[model samples]
Target: MALIETRDLRRVYDLDAGRVVALDSVSLDIDKGDFVAVMGPSGSGKSTFMNLVGCLDKPTTGHYRLADTAVERLDADGLARLRNREIGFVFQQFNLLPRVDALGNVELPMVYAGFDRRTRRERALHALGRVGLAERAHHRPMQLSGGQQQRVAIARALVNGPSLLLADEPTGALDSRTANEIMALFQELNREGVTIVLVTHDAEVGRHAHRLIRFRDGRVTEDHRQVPVDARALAREAAE
Candidate 1:
């Protein structure tokens, strides 16, 4: 079965100005290990779609089945559990606690999930190692570079061993070189069979994904497969 299946997914809001349609009749299936990028201009429904797909918000009217579980049927606690078990989120800001070191930040999710102290430390360290940040585990967020902070965020996201990763402009805050490094890490994760759904406004960033889906005016305007740009290759060429 597809990992994520949405049929006619629609979200509408009733504001003082009558009604607003944030998303309309959207349908798509994201397979396991798929690397899909969602792109659009402001108010194009991309963020709305991401919110719905990440289970942060429910659709006003539509069908969304995540891992064959009816998402629309889940209560608040069920939704929280599903998100904790099945989804990891990476944001543009690399939202780490300023006073905490990398290890502490990465352990937060496990703490919420009720992992034992020892287990949380072990898993957080392993996740940091996976993102090439093992040696920097003790560094606080302020002590790290932009790329390093973002790596810490990625490590935290992966610490849960989530099946699906939802990243919103993961590289948007970094310099070109740093952005390339982050994208390379994402590509590596994709190769290792982690499904990713990334939302970005940059076409260059979106081109790194295997599939592209574009939104416009509360609807899907484009969806297709493409040969992804090799982030590793780009980084190599830059170093040469």
Candidate 2:
């Protein structure tokens, strides 16, 4: 079954000014292990789609299913539980606590999930290692480079073993080199069977995904599979 499914999904906001249609009858399916990049200009419904798929928001007039569970049927608490278990979010800002070290930041999710201290430590360490940051676990976010900090954030998102990784312009804060490194990491993770849905305005970053989905004026304008560029190779080429 597809990891994500939406049919005639729509989101409308009743503002003081008037009603704003943020999403308009969008329908699509994202298969397990697919690496999809969502692209659009500001106010083009891409963010709205991400929010709905991430269980962060509900569609006002349509159906959505994540791993076959009907999203609209879930209560607020149920949506929270689904998000906690099935989705990992990576934001452009990294969102790390200034006072906490990488290990501690990664452990926050598990703590909320009621994991014991030992298990949280073990899992956080493993997650850091996955992002090639095991040695930086003791370092605070301030001490790490931009790429390293983003890596830590990615590790935190993965610590819960979520079925889907939803990244919002994850490479936006980095330089080209750093962004390429992060994209390489994402490609590597996707090859390891982690389904990823990335929202970005950068065309270079979007080309690294196996599929491209473009939104415009509250509708999907394009959706197609493509041969992804090799991000790791591009990074290495830049280094040379």
Candidate 3:
């Protein structure tokens, strides 16, 4: 089923100079368990679309349905509740608490979800393990490398078992080598059936997804999937 559907989605800002259309009547659908990437230049509507999809902002017009819930009709509190349960976000900055260890960082979402201490601990450990960070669970963010820190951030995003993972420029701050490692992690998660929507300007990064959606001048310009990466390529990557 389509987990996300948007029909003529739009966002407009009333500026001093004139009305600015940040998003212009965009329509799209993303099915469950799909790995999709959104790519565009600075002024494109991709970021605006991401905000709407992430429930961080409301659309100016049209419809947005996420997991069968009409996003536009929800009140602020309702939206917050839905977001808490349904969306997991990974940002470019890693966004970890400097003093907090990996386990504590992963436990944060469960704390917000009101899980009991024991359950939170168990789930946090499992999530950290999923990201291959179990051994470093006690290490502070500053003690970890950039790739490891991003993995912790990924674990935190997964701790709540959210229906969707929304990543915004997740590798933007990392070096090429570190970025590839994180992308491989994302692929692993997707292979395990997590739905992912990644936003990036890098074409190589965007190509990692099962499908690509490109935006330009506040509208969608292309939506298509390319050939999957070969196993040989993946094996070579792993050996590096």
Point to the candidate with the largest lDDT.
2
Worst 10 residues of 2 by lDDT: 228-237
lDDT of each: 0.91, 0.93, 0.90
Report the C-alpha lDDT of model 3 over 1-240, residue by residue, as the tens digit. 578999999999899999999999999988767789999999898999999999999999999999999999999988887777889899999999998899999998888788999998899899999999899999999999999999999999998888799999999999999999999999988877688999999999998998899999899999997645334534543564
lDDT of 1 by residue, 28-61 (tens): 9987777899999999999999999999999999
The true-versus-predicted C-alpha distance at residue 72 of model 3, in Å, is 0.9
TM-score of each: 0.93, 0.93, 0.92
Question: What lDDT is obtained when candidate 2 is compared to the true structure?
Answer: 0.93
In candidate 2, which residue pairs get closer than 3 Å at backbone N, Cα or C atoms, i.e. clash? none
Q: How far is 13's C-alpha from truth in model 1 (Å)?
A: 1.4
Clashing pairs in 3: none
Model 1, TM vs. native:
0.93
| Candidate 2: count of backbone clashes, pairs at least 3 residues apart or interchain | 0
Which residue pairs does candidate 1 place in steric collision?
A: none
Position 207, candidate 1: lDDT: 88
